[model samples]
Target: MTGGPSRGARGGRAWREGHAAEWIAALWLMLKGYRILGFRLKSRAGEIDILARRGRVLAVVEVKRRKTMQAALAALTPHQTARLVAAAQQVVRGRKALQALEIRLDLVALAPGRFPRHRRGVGA
Candidate 1:
């Protein structure tokens, strides 16, 4: 049964890749003047890739990694976007700190040989 790496190993590799992508996305967001509040934040609805704030705005970010920019953008499906939006709302509902800030959905797309693409106000 040693034809190739096992399913668990593949999943571990994917997890590592996603982790690195999230770190890159977080750094990029910081560079753009956002203070990172959470990374890999789990909510009752779903997992939030990153939560960041700047001035009076709070950003709920979704990170996607793919072979190309188009593919990365396409990775964020409508269903996932809905889940992210719901998760953001559910997670922020009880937090007074975030309640005062304007909330927005953001995307950080990672592709090989290119800078991370950050798009604000996505899926709004």
Candidate 2:
């Protein structure tokens, strides 16, 4: 009789929602003509939600879900941004296919009842 909900309960809900948002973002990118190279790619730097490519550009996408577009866009901080960039570098280093592509950090912000807003070359 101390806390609101157990850690597992809260974490499970968040994990499920994050996964759903990432899938939605991936589909949206596909429709826009990008090929998804990976999802939930993890490196020692951090976790990249999605890795997509179009022509010579490789997009390292970070998905955010919030009540509003503004909130979602504001969710990532400078430190987090740095980590994302570092993660993207790590991802490219590990994938020979990504070697020749131009890597960019992108943001895909999703809110309820709204299409995902994509911001390319963010934190670059």
Which candidate number maximizes lDDT? 2
Candidate 2 vs. true structure, TM-score: 0.93
Residue 69, model 2: lDDT of: 92
Q: How much is 121 displaced in model 1, in angstroms?
A: 0.9
Among all windows of 10 consecutive residues in model 2, the one with the lowest summed lDDT is 1-10
Residues 2-71, candidate 2: write the lDDT tens digits: 6698888999999999999999999999999999999988999999999999999999999999999999
In model 2, what is the error at residue 40, expressed in angstroms?
1.0
Error of 2 at 92 (Å): 1.1
lDDT of 1 by residue, 1-124 (tens): 8899999999999999999999999999999999999998888889999999999988999999999999997788888889888898887897977888888989999998999999998887
On a 0 to 1 TM-score scale, where does candidate 1 land against the true structure? 0.94
**What are the lDDT figures for the candidates, one per model?**
0.92, 0.93
